[model samples]
Target: MRDIIEPEFEIDEKGRVLCKTHSNFEFFSQPKVNRYQQRELEKQLTCETCSHFFNDDCFFPRSEVNMIEYDRKKRNAFKCKLCGNKIDRMLTVMHKLYYKEKYNIELPLICCTCYETLKDGKFIESSKWRSNMFLYNALYAIYSLISVLFFILVYQVRIYYLLVFLLPIIYLFYQNMKKRKEIKEGMRYYQKYFIDSNNNNIR
Candidate 1:
């Protein structure tokens, strides 16, 4: 069983919950998307994922916690990069640091499953991938639809004339398929990896 510490937040002077432990509270980590759409301003700022409420070092009442990520995290709308599942857009301080240290890339706002998958060493070179596979999926669907159209046109007397139009469509699909393969290949892992819990700073 994972030992997730209870959320350690404190009431501010105004009696509002707050956590001032992040490396930079004013960091430009929030995406250009609708960051404030859902009402979790307090949670986002406090960052329950951190072990420190404000960098409590030794000798003092220090902050400490184990590593725990989430899916169905908040009632916000953000999509996962791998499975294309809906997720909240809570880019905690840990995620930002992890991305920079591990992948040397920007932290992607992913669902819990994808985050777990990444920690388990099934994903790498994530920067080459996309946040959504919608365009790739649309390409595949269009190719299938065009194939059905080709079948219907094959029986027509103007089949030769229709071939010219279908040829261009087929080329486009081929290019998109090649790009899709590249995206999937980037997610392949060279070896299994695991993130050990800090118990103090956490993964």
Candidate 2:
């Protein structure tokens, strides 16, 4: 079995849930898509029975992915340069660091699995700090201790003060649980995409 880490999704500055492994395609790695080039790639890719067909238009004749089917469909969607799978997600490969246009050109739609394998399982970006359970646990411990001390030393008469003190911790715990549930749901979507009916990994 291939040992896989549970993929972590980071909330970007734009509030998008993005995978951790992000990278630029190598400088000379862009694909050529004329008939002759497609023929060449097809011979090498036929072992996997996958298509390496490319077009300037979108790869999917009709895709359920909105950004792919609509926004980027005509202009940016193309065959994945790596495995030749239908482009599902595009990775920003080129850009000006100092200029406003952060991503000038995006690579073909390379799925997350291929991206991970190509990068040798190194995540380029990370937000695991947001979900560090130990940190939350420590905060919970400290909060509980402080609440008990405050109740005993300051507000002993009204038991309601303890509930008031504990409300923020309760809300924090709720938010943590909600985020964990969301992550689990996201992982399920990835598993669905990668696993096929024959139990073979498609990506």
Candidate 3:
């Protein structure tokens, strides 16, 4: 006789289970597209300055909207021929598919233009402190090395004299800290801008 065992639990990407089964197997649906992909598609489909597809002259034939009335058009009104869904929503769906097929990444919803832009560029240019930190640390190390050499050659100072060379090190440290703080603030500002831009684009 075959043994019968009850199912343990269900699995899902967002933790919301859809069903339970008699077998001891689990299933999970895919996750949504990511913000990076969405941002990329937005860049591809819309004008960087205005987040619309066309300009005053309607230079791009593929654009769905005329530049003049682009702002007045509702997002839900523009339908995709392939999916019969809103153009923006269709873009998000396509982006998710593309991300899965191309990069093997299960991303959240992303607009068409943002996906294109990210695919073309590979990644966004968000500010980070690592670069600044590297620069400051490199400079400080170089200056410290030079000061140690000078002390040894001119004053014949012992290796302990290296401790006295920390004046420049402290100064550079302060500058690096300040610069890192500024970069962090700038990152927050840009993050806010990204969120605001996404909200406006959806509307």
Candidate 4:
């Protein structure tokens, strides 16, 4: 239920949920942190998967979050300093901000994949990310197949009202297309900043 959101038939459905850490704390006040009180005093944490964290509500980098890809050529378009792989923009920034705030150390670009590495200094991206992604895709494929079969059956029967089954499929497709556009443009925008910053750093 919390993993995905289904938008209305006629409306744009973008899933927005706070990561566990920030879910406790909203805009106005700090969420209750019993053992984390000391850490809370130092700096407010940001959710790496949220676009709003970057002050951009126009785009949700779902691709960056889901990162569903196997092509090595497309790995980490913005190479992470740690793994030299495509990295999540928000995760990198979140790591930077957290380190700067907590340890007073500035970190270079790091990916969510490198989290365990950073934690244990092992430099190995956990396989769970890929495994979880595979699971999601497998489930998605099942959904798509069912949708196609349902659509075909309903169409062949020429049932008028039963076409409602297709509505969810159609709605999701449109929403997917809409988010794909946003992700495409969002990557470009992030790429521009990456280039500029890289150039500046090199200078």
Winner of 2 and 3 under TM-score? 2
Q: lDDT values of the candidates?
A: 0.44, 0.38, 0.42, 0.42
Q: Clashing pairs in model 1? A: none
For model 4, the local distance difference test gives 0.42
| Residue 143 displacement in candidate 4 (angstroms) | 7.0
Write candidate 4's Cα lDDT for 1-203 as tens digits.
Answer: 12332111110111111233233334314444465663452234334323343433312234433442222235534545543445533333434444565569865554455444445644322333443454455456458858667777867855654456567655655555443443344344434554567677633
TM-score of predicted structure 3: 0.26
Q: Best to worst by TM-score, what's the order?
A: 2, 4, 1, 3
Q: What's the lDDT for candidate 3?
A: 0.42
Clashes of 3: 18
Model 3: per-residue Cα lDDT over 1-203, one tens digit each: 33322222332333222223211112122333787753553344222223122222212222433431252245444432221223443333433444565569864433333334335642134234343664677577677778677878898778676767766676776666655564465445434554577677633
Worst 10 residues of 4 by lDDT: 6-15
> Tens-digit lDDT track for model 2 on 22-122?
22111113354477864543333211121211211222212223343343446644543333334442222111111223335332344444455535633
Alpha carbon lDDT at 61, candidate 2: 18
Candidate 3 Cα errors over 4 Å, as ranges: 1-126, 129-164, 200-203
Considering summed lDDT, which 10 consecutive residues are worst modelled in model 2?
Answer: 91-100
Question: What are the TM-scores, per candidate, against the unseen true structure?
Answer: 0.28, 0.31, 0.26, 0.29
